[model samples]
Target: MFNLIKNEWIKIFSRPGTYVMIGLLVLLVIGAGSVMKFAGVSQEPEGDWKQQTQMQIESDKQYLEEMGGSENFQTQYYKQQVAINEYRLANDIEPASGESIWSFVNFNSNFVEIIGLFAIIVAAGIVASEFTWGTIKLLLIRPISRTKILLSKYITVLLFGITLLLTLFLLSTLVGAIFFGGGDGQPHLVYIDGAVEEQNMVFYLIKTYLLKSISITMMATMAFMISAVFRSSSLAIGISLFLLFMGGTATQFISMKYDWAKYSLFANTDLTIYTGAMQPLVDDMTLGFSVTMLIIYFVIFHLLAFIVFKKRDVAA
Candidate 1:
């Protein structure tokens, strides 16, 4: 079983597309960092701090007039602006824009949602590709039990998942730090119960990133089950893509008609969206509900995959 998993891992890493994906991730981080770094240095200073601050005040006043000045996120934004103006006045700090590229980089550094999807595709295709390419016969002829073979393939998918996630994390942080100035190491703030508090933002970011990785694994498992049942790689890919896009849409109807819709996987996919929507959708949500839905979705997908894969005959 161990050897089988190792061989599967080798196969996954050796694929040309794997390296291509890695290259793309690095390029995105570098390109994003470069754009922001230059943007800060290149912008002409908005000199005359007093005038600039007044301009912001007028802008906020106009916005308040437009919205009738409700106590909302916009109002909060302006309140902070007022504080910033006071700070600038007291300290004699010109509105000198420093390299905030690192902040931008840090904020976006953990966008592993789509990147992790690529990992899911690779994993889904691992066993399915062997079948598609007529290599299943060779695999089945080995002395290993069918369950052991499947377990090995699944373990390889996990290793592939972890490797891809770490690659995104380390590379983004390293490149971001180098291209931009070093971190201010401010507390990463997470919102709970409509209040923002200083917390371990870095750790939270990592935990969220890992959660995205798990979501990708769930996607892979979904594809694997489809591939196992349908015995067609194209069909598997089609189903995965359709569900990937439309799942949330379908869940919306359920939410309207039935209370059970909160448990849909699509509802949980974008943790960012669910996290006290900075710009919330109608009927804003709770974190507990989203987390619950995701857990059930994953468990059911894996259970279905195991059952169907174990029962299905390999013959084409």
Candidate 2:
């Protein structure tokens, strides 16, 4: 299996599109950083832009106490007061400001949308590339099992996800160093109470990207399975891409209107969203829980890919 994996690696690396995707990811990270760098948008690392505002609120309340409640602004506290209550209800932890880059890139991740979109491209490209150049026959004729071939392809595709993310992180760090200047790698999630919860940005970024990678892996597995079943890589990719976007909307709708959303693969689309937009998890649902679901989904698709590929006839 290892050798099979290696052989799959060679074939995958040999493709030009693989490197192209890596290059694109490099550009994306650099581009985003460049935008941040050039725009003069230094976000408060304490999560959310209004860390100072939260601080001010605390100060105001303290002042009010000292003044014997002589002055009070209902407007200021009322707006955030409900949010505070909900934060406490949803998470035992007090609502923090967010992250160092919340103001700039907090909602930008939309992991499900990003990873789902990425998966379609990578997944379709995996088998589409083989069939595009008419080399799929050579692929199947090898001594390796068809199931192993698909697994190898899946691995190679996943490596692409890792490489792309690594490039983005490295480029971001470099850009941040060169353009934004060096800052602490430690990421802190600030609460509404003005207390900061520290998270290693590097580690958090790694874990977040891995979650994204897993999402992409599920996508790749699904696409590969489609390719095996359809035997038309282009059709497989096209179909998968179509389904990705559609599944996202459909799944969200189902989650809202029906009670079966949790059962759907698309239901667990966004890891960030699953964590309540990084708000925090109070119930059984968590980033870890979402990842487990993803793993189960990946395994199911993986098995299906192997089963179909092993049994399918080669027509091309």
Candidate 3:
């Protein structure tokens, strides 16, 4: 199994395209850091930070009161803002004096979608390309069982996905530090149970990263299943990318009128709601419920992939 995984891993990195993808991602992070550095120096003089924070807090309070009766997502957003601002005011945690490394790293979280796109491309192609390139027969004729072969490929793709994520994190942090000093420890303020709480910034960032990556996992799994069943990398990649862009929006629209939308794969894929990023689409939705739904979908995806692969006939 280890050797198979290693071989698969080697195959992935053996391609110059993989290196190009990684390089492009790094360049993207650096470009974002440069833009952030020059965008706004926050010319607010040092002495007025407290006053500024206090004013922001009061404004948020007003907004919160105004939004008190609205049960939509925007209300939850305002509530979260109110909680965080109040916490910052209470804790005397002024905003960063400038764009620090921590701020840059935090800002880079928005780019996780790019990482997911790379992962989806890899996952979408990894299995189907074997057939596309006419290497399936050679791969299966090895003494390895078909199940182990598929598992190795899946593991390899997942490892590749994780590698891309970590690359983004590490490169963003290093580049951010180079551009913005590292003196400030990025701290996060979270709203919980009608109150704002201070949490380890690193922990929050890592949690955010993992939660956001779940969509990649689901899309990759879908692509892998499509590849195994259809033996077409382009088809798998097209559908996966289309869903990646439109799935969340479609899910939101579905959730507006349908209670069953809570069971949707996209709805559960975004685990950030559990971390209070927003209110659940269904008031009854909980972390456990979403996890269970995801697990069911995950099992179904793998079952389709493996069953199709195990029975698939390769023309010599």
The candidate that achieves the highest lDDT relative to the unseen native structure:
3
Across residues 189-284, which tens digit of lDDT does each residue of candidate 2 receive? 423332323455455555555555555666667887776666677787787787767876776656555655666776674564432123222223
User: Against the true structure, what is each candidate's TM-score?
Assistant: 0.75, 0.69, 0.93
Candidate 1 has what TM-score? 0.75
What 10-residue stretch in candidate 2 is worst by lDDT? 275-284
Clashing pairs in 1: 188-201
For model 3, what is the C-alpha lDDT against the true structure? 0.84
Query: What is the lDDT for 237 in model 2?
Result: 73
The digit string of per-residue lDDT tens for model 3 on 1-316 reads: 9999999899989999899999899889988987777875564456677787777778877877887677788767876876777677777886756677776777888888887788888888889889888888899889989999999999988898888889888988899878887746647677766666677877887888888888778888888888888888899989988988898889899998998999888889888877766788888898999999999999999999999899988976
Clash total of candidate 3? 0
RMSD of each: 4.8, 7.9, 2.0
Computed on alpha carbons, the lDDT of every model, listed in order, comes to: 0.66, 0.58, 0.84
